[model samples]
Target: MIDEPEPRRQTPQELRGLVGSANIPTLLMVIYQVTRDERWLRPPYLPTRSKGLGDHDSGGLPEPVQEEIRAAGVRALLDLQDGRAPAIALPDPEQTRRMLEACVGEPVDRSYGEMFAREFRRRAGADDGPARPVRGGSDLRVLVIGAGVSGIIAAHRLERMGVSYLVVDKHDAPGGNWLDNRYPGAGVDTPSHLYSFSFAPRDWTQHFELRGELERYFADTFDRIGARPRTRFGTEVVRAEFDEGRQLWDVELRDSDGLRESISVNAIVSAVGILNRPFVPALPGLELFGGPSFHSSEWNDDLDVTGKRVAVIGSGASAMQIVPAIAPSVRGLTVFQRTPPWVAPFEKFQQPIDPGARYLLRTFPLYRTWYWLKLYWQFGDKVLDALRKDPDWPHPERAVNARNDGHREFFTQYIRDELAGREDLFGKVVPDYPPFGKRILLDNGWYRALCRPNVELVNEAVTSVVEGGVVSSSGAVHEADVLVWATGFTASRFVSSLEIIGRDGQSLREAWDDDDARAYLGVTVPGFPNLFLLGGPNSFPGSGSFMHFMEVQMRYVGRLLTCMFDLDIRAIDVRKDVFDEYAELVDRTSATTVWTHPGTDTFFRNSRGRLVFVSPFRNVEYWTRAQSAGLEDYEIVAAP
Candidate 1:
């Protein structure tokens, strides 16, 4: 944990001003956490449930009641500052659970109380966490692939474990998808407060940060964590083969300069992330297009389309952002959709964090932690219940369950409201699939952009490309001077490009059989000993931050490495039975979710329409399961 001082304090006047504008619920939680005050948890101070996805800054409380809580909270916070009052230790688990329930204005399960407590911000002076058992120093040397978010996180955990490691990425710098996907208006659909690393907090300006700022956060984080010295930029992993006798991975890497190098390490972490390779569809006459064309991931920064006609051939996340960003400037914009996505209402999309709110987050450590925790709960497992399938539900065609139907209604109304007078655009924008059937996008003027006179939304699948435009399956040609393919990535194809040759010369590609990838807890494979997969298949949480998921996985990896070092084990291969059982569990649970809904096309599914990409488990379930790595689940090889 970072042992720096508590975040810098603001002037008393500034604190009052910031507290005045802060969320009453979060402020009340902070007050209770800081001063051990039971009053904040009582009747008048308790918050009402903030419905939908909005922040509910006022906590649905009357102005006088909010002011009263703010006044009391500010006083407690002021006392905690300077030397007058000490930062109070976090209360016991039950109390913490009560505080969480009170803040969210709903019941927080007793089981998740401890997990909630641990995930509380790890800033200095916050003694809410248990001390981690440090383990390292052996013959272990790790090769971490990709310097993206997961890779950076891997390096940090490795350092904490005292393990020797090297980070390699094809890009000259860090920021994986953030680095590669630089399309206009590209930003996070998740809240900024929870999207970032728990250890390295930023006083982010916006709730959902754009690509440039998010990219900078990663690059800056890479440097701040001292990963640069241990990282080899512009290096790509060509192949990694397991050496049966030596219990090491023989890795080959190619540099940007075309130089090749070979190395052997005790373990290999494929931090290469799920969404690395861009998938450009092979269409009829795509090469015949005379004008400039490129995928959204490979955006042409210098090729400005100030007045040029542009065709965006995808209706996913990237297109949602790009169509709106270029709409005002482009002479004409045409969006082609194979299938529409469920777009949720994001009130804070592209909106700046208020100056007062920013001050509260920046100045108060407890306030930041509590506020962040609130976002985590909102964006996380609270929504998982809606995705659960109910066989008894009559309208299985539209939603998985009654709760799921409610979500569909909410999202449908949101779309209708956004498309109000432009009813023509509604049919083109709304999806036929059930809610949460695929990745749900957040509306950042996507619906509004379609209403523009120059913007045309085409619901037909793009049949081909011609000299000047895209040809839809309806045989209509949409003309354009430029084409932006936001066709997404080879997401289900885990650890793409790099060939992994496991024991018995079984290739990872052969095991996955091209897109049917499975991992035991989205980590290790049976034959690939000491080869850990970070952000592996079926580990994708349907909701919550990927950053949080990666953190827990890395921690589990550290524990496994610690076991290996302490036991003098040469290699620990995940037992075949254990892996199979886990995979079976994943498949069984997946059948109960909307991702497995028949005929709904998504990157979440593989060739046979199996849900291979996303995890069937809730985010909390994964966090609880991955808390510790046990050697019993693996076949341990002894050192020579």
Candidate 2:
């Protein structure tokens, strides 16, 4: 006898556990969406920091009122999950814009709202439809190089579109930079929620997760998407030559066994990201160092440094993370700084997520989406204005303008607060350049690390690596048992290691002579037909989650490929005029930003002092441009 299933229990604890205070605003917004209730749009439920957009302000609400709202939200969530509530229509473009503006505490344009709505719908499993096969596009064979974030995203989209593809990487597995950079304190500075793929959300335990968790996330993402089976590990693409007659790319690959092979594919997606290569400066007597020396990217974990003297070179992002991590353990730690970086304050930079927050993210419907969007607003384009040059302001060197000067003051004050009573460290740590002129680092106890008794902050350039340790420009040799070069990558040299020959046998190196790498929308080039770059020149978002940029670029690439298949086109190249125009626009926009300021010398700029690494446009602007493949922007050639 089949017994009727017992009614599922719904208790207050279960409901309360499903939502957190951080997500209260979002839950209310969703309730408003479903019920059209004006009550959900008011005080305690709504954001309260800056006219209902910034941080959550629950202090104004009585405890009883907050509880009532939570109870209502849980009931709504349960109803929605149990199919008791009718499905609500996706937010209209205007509603989406206003909602995001209210959530972000900043004015957002229509394009941003539309982008957010599309992403929201997609994440909610309410997007247009699942990817269906195109009737005429079965002959496409694409090769994606690198199994990093960009490569994984590109592969996932290609599979969704029902296109045949293969991914190859030099590493044994996925997680490009995460896999390589396993130094003492290697982790992402970006918030974990916002740093991940929008489609594949996880309940992150930390605000800024470490290397292992990130690597696991990437591996899990690759496995979940069934991308691992399509990837060839320990296989590196050495060169790719476009066969103009056949309209295919002949890719040369070398496997782990030192065996070379060639594969012909209809198109190529170069996702070997900017940060793969390690750049160790040619310091005098570098090879003469008698102790163990290594770049932070190529970390030697087996070497023990406890109670040993360790010299860390470069005070960039990596150094900022490493010094704090190793200072307590090492007997003596000397940090060599070429220049001080502008570190922004973050309260939870090193804190883990509360259990209640994790519970809300895991159990509640649309809670993670709302949280991500809120973070996107807070960290995304909000800082863009400060990066732009104010023509009316007189001080361009110390700061870009009054707003940028305010930022400088704020950051300086934070530093002063962190290093209170230690005026000696103040002169050594404060940067002279404008805020956002360089990559802004999150202060993960970096100031506190400097104040440690065992740690010494040397603000002098390293002249050479002596027999025992690093020799500063002041002619003082700082001895150490280990030397860690935290210097960054050759970011401007996009895919420079690979020999890629395009139309008329012109190599990519020759096309980008003197490291003048430029691409249309940072994806397509004039001579490189049917070849797309994932994280190419000018693709780095100046101030936002780079993962968002990757997703946008991948979608654009996917759209381009789908268009090619639909039109029966074999190869597509950006028009030279279009490429030149876009390059000029990029250069012009860059000239008006702080990255191009004369006082700044960062990896963001190329050898010619051009802003080659970072994008000058807003995230929403890039999203709008990358949402579609403009057929007129390229010259499509039919297959022979």
Candidate 3:
């Protein structure tokens, strides 16, 4: 008889995972974390610092060195998985600081290192940390508005602290903009790992998740927090007036059907995100259009675009996503642009996770944690230096500094490469302004889509709407069967949906001067007691993880509540001087940033050319301050 064929041997799962891609430095850290091995942090295994989105898989190391790290990583991880070693080992603060520096190949400030460690420990159950209710939190009642990401964040914090709170939204479910914007190819520009909650969020299917998935994530997040049972859906808080005698807010609620109701609560947290409202420009003859017209926010999913002539007005984020998705199906397409936006290379646009890598991210705790840290470092505070303006640098018209100019050149070349043969499309698409001056868009084949023969890129503002077409400012008629207003939102209008009456019957609109909104640390106003604003004036880090900042804001809110409990206070409003000083500081610092570049017009500024929205502070600074802005900054009312 012939010798029986030997059955094929299967590699261990952890070893199988090792063959897939990884951030080598992150993997080294993970190995050290898993095995508590000193060799991983030593000279031979240390990584050479690399930049951009490249995996730098071998970490610019010799092949032998990479082989050893990967092999050791797999073995260490298996030990953890098989219960031979501790499940999630961590370094001492000093060693962690050393590892952080060694891994990144740069000196990390102790302040930032401390902040990083705190975030690692506190971020939504990154470990088995206790969640103790704030002292006196059980007695407090909170009214959270807009059950979007921000509102849901508040609910999660409140529930953890054993605080009584209710969330309200006009939409029937938890999603805010994600619920509203269902246009084709709607997704986040931020990376999936860094864009999520720190407290053990689910592994994402894509590098950057799209609308439907994001919507589901929010709904699921709310459900997980046990928030839905306490949420009043299809309800809008139209008015809120401070009752001096009661020392509480009297809130007016309007349902989706226009039915009204009222309630009172100890505190109000406005989770109404910055981009909640859609702005449809009042173009002349829009009513005269024979074809159907709609804003990009209220996308009609049922309407078919196949074989139809479509005109998308406004070459912003929404238009970028919509045009590419529908361009293939539409017979003809016209994109009206007022100004071209700076487009960045979306490294993993539409890229799916590798199976083995996904398995590791899901199964290995240390692997997931280190991967998140890698993303945060790569995408976060690192970009700020390039964004800071160098006033002495020449050619301020084209770029901010050498680094900023390099970004512009890279983006310009990216546009050129995408539309190589079509040189005529260059002038129309390449921006003249400095990079980061406007909101930077992810490429995602937008330039290639614009190069399509059937698509037309009109380099002018939409001045009017005709019977069957949109009229450009140059009087050019772009004929179409359908019209889409992707003009973005009225971002300058903060909290416009609610008519808030603060101390002495002062309307919030009047306090904000109708358009210019200001809040102390972008959460509290001087006159609004027991009131907090999420994503309020200057809170945004311009570009970063929205979820991270939302958590920080709510955590700050938690600290404020703790302060109240400590002081035996009933209500606390930001002191007027404190608010004004913060505003002054913001204005002064913002003036020196690339965001304030006059060469580009952006929603980051208000009508008066004031930088009203974007936060000028570094991520670390904001994170640190949010943890402790102090009770001294507030004017408090004594508890009964």
Query: How much lDDT does each candidate structure score?
Result: 0.83, 0.81, 0.81
Among all windows of 10 consecutive residues in model 1, the one with the lowest summed lDDT is 124-133
Q: Tell me the spans in candidate 3 whose CA falls farther than 4 Å from its real position.
A: 1-14, 17-19, 35-39, 42-44, 53-64, 84-88, 92-98, 102-107, 123-130, 638-640
lDDT of 1 by residue, 87-202 (tens): 45665567667888899888888877777777763543364222343444534689999988899989888766667889999989898888778778888888988888876788
TM-score, candidate 3, is 0.94
What is the C-alpha RMSD, rounded to one decimal, of candidate 2? Answer: 3.5
Ten contiguous residues with the weakest lDDT in model 3: 1-10
Give per-residue CA lDDT, model 3, range 262-374, as digits (tens): 89998999999879688998877989999879999998889898999999999999998999999999999999998998888777898887766666666666667666665
The candidate with the higher TM-score, 1 or 2, is 1
- What is the full ranking by TM-score, best candidate first? 1, 2, 3
Please tell me which model should have the higher lDDT, number 1 or number 3: 1
Across 402-442, the per-residue lDDT of candidate 2 in tens digits comes to 98898889889889999978999999889999998999888
**Model 2: how far is 573 from its true place, Å?**
1.3
Clashes of each: 0, 0, 1
Looking at candidate 1, what is the lDDT of residue 538? 87
